[model samples]
Target: MDNVEVPDYFICPISLQIMKDPVTAATGITYDRESIEHWLLMRHNTICPVTKQPLPRDSGLTPNHNLLRLIQSWRRSTGNSPGAAAQMDKRKTQETSLNQSHIDKLIRGIGNPDSQLKSLQKLEALAIENEPRRKQLVEFGVHNAALHFIMQCHRGKNTNASGLPEALHVLYLIRNSSNGLKLSQMEDVIGEIIEAFSWVLGCDGETLNKTHAIFAMKMVVRKAKSAQLRMLKPEFFQKLVDYVKQRGNKQGINAALQVMLDSSPWGRNRIMLVEAGAPFELIELELKSPEKKTTELILGILFHLCSCADGRAQFLSHAAGVAMVSRRILKVSPAADDRAMLILSLISKFSGTNGVLLEMLRVGAAAKLCLVIQSNRESHLKDKAREILRTHSNAWKASPECLNLPTLTSDDVC
Candidate 1:
């Protein structure tokens, strides 16, 4: 890197990395597309990184075609080809050599300070270009190797620090790319992986590194055996909740949400999440425009959290909690609707104060329940919705609006 005399204009202000797909923002400054998008869209920043100018939240990024061509020409002139170009193309795929001996040698070489950097660069290049390479790396125990590599950094071993980031990147890419990868194979190190991720979350690192840590944590937590999931500590859950509150990146937030969902199946995990203030944060997240799966997982966590009184109270503490759940019933997906119903059921059955019931009515929670019953979708969910309405019918029935609306079914035993 010291040998390279790249032009100052070529670096992204946020990541300080060479601009691959350069884009010009409304602020008249250029940035790498991925880096700027992470800043604006993922981190929800409203200011341009370089100019410090206020950017409209929805401002569009214009591609810097001229800068891109110049960068490409420079790379070609520098003979950095093939390697730099391959690394830039995230979607590029390649066939792995599948040489077990070669893989073993790379893993062993990672212990050497000087060689570790070169090995990690090579591995990261291989891991990013294709699924086959990632699969092969996992097959050759790169998962454990990469985890150990990060652990070495934590342990103050491998004093040469050049490749630790790349090693982590490769680890995240391997787990994310390969479907057959399993955490069961590394059960002994699950705690170490969690510890490493907690360290990453707390440390001031590159945004991508923190993002990778959250993704890796999600994968490890999701794939751990049932017993292992139940054994996770509150500190781990607290770290995840902190990540959610930090709102560092969208991918990281979604990963944290997934980790909570995967871990929430355990009763204690739900309490931990609730105690971590996950419900309020999740409700706030829902108010933002999240991807479909993100919304579903958030709702799923809320459903589990609502199972307990503390969770229900925390969820209801959010001003938009009831309204947000009502709005998502028919708008998102079937899975979301199912979970949202359970959340409402828990609140109505246990915490239905007069104010809560009135708030539900005002927020269209009552209307949503009626729609659920009329639609006859997901019979179990419909049944629960009916129970909520009927159980509170005396309160609802007193309302002239409720009286003017549809009549109660025979199931309104209350």
Candidate 2:
């Protein structure tokens, strides 16, 4: 890293102005960490200005002390456009009442560093002459601005809205686009949400994804909690998978997948996530864009499904699908034993009765399992494969044709 040249664009958005105390000109944003800290280590602050919520940070990047933070940092290496979320806090009644500092403090007070939320009763009392300020506070708030402020930095800051606007028009585009395009949007949203949760709210991705806020927006709704927000899920998921296929971007893919896994619970907003065409779609996609990791993910999903009696039955019931999957595993031959163990787990799920077990044997799956025990070098995998082998060994002992075949070892009685 010492030898690595830090590009000029790597300059902090706050520091581009060359101020000793650089601040986000557009969002009036500042972090507990700053530019130099960010340059030294990427971990600083990803907090939202209005919510005082710190954004979630991923383990993939290093920690920085002085950087403006990813929210301020990741907006661009060069920097944010600064106008989309920009607003005028102009005074009305033909005269201004307070200075910008007062206004900034008041707005920040809504999500004060300590605890900014004013009581609703207090808010109602304050609204006698200053109702517009309350509306202003709400508009400037990060929870309300989660999608808007984040998206505004990219576009539509100039678009009119007294408060957070419906972003479904853009979200619909994000949802309907191909897996590739939707992923790009998901990246932006993930980064923004991370920034919101970690920097603004100071929670990790694990917490944010699991929170009621996320669920309120994404899961558990007659029509997804927040329809626009819901549009992003499948797109985000599909994109992580796409990254693995197109670039072999292991680090990137894993980081993206981490977001999905964190966001694991079906927001219940839509079924597109857990039951989207993803698992089935992946089989075809992976054949062309095979990545060891994506294969592992697919295998993990199948393993999860196969673990339950009902799930296993359903998984096996899709005989055509199972056949395709078995062939895919064959294609991944010389695959790690862990992968073989994963396959063996799936195999173990099925009833080893004549039909299914014989079908597995006929499809060349049994031969493959036998080969796994004979050939695997990984100890953990080998041990599990041996356990599975014991199951098959019983079958071999029961059938004369298998009994006549080569023995696993001389110690075995014929």
Write the residue-wise lDDT of candidate 1 on 1-414 in tens digits. 224455668767655567889999988999899877765643222656556567886779999999999988887776764555445333223223467898888888888876987677666655654466678888788878788888877666433357767776777778765575566667887877787777777676676777788888887877677887777787888888888877777777888888888889878988888888899999887787566888999999999899999999998889999999998997889999998898898899899998898888878888888888878588887788878887898887776656444645455423
Write down the lDDT of every candidate, Cα atoms only: 0.77, 0.39
| Candidate 1: stretches off by over 4 Å | 1-95, 156-161, 176-178, 182-185, 400-414
For candidate 2, lDDT tens digit of each residue in 35-117?
43342232123433234344444422333335534335545443433331121111132121334454445445433324332
Report lDDT (Cα) of residue 149, candidate 1.
83
Give lDDT for model 2: 0.39
Worst 10 residues of 1 by lDDT: 88-97
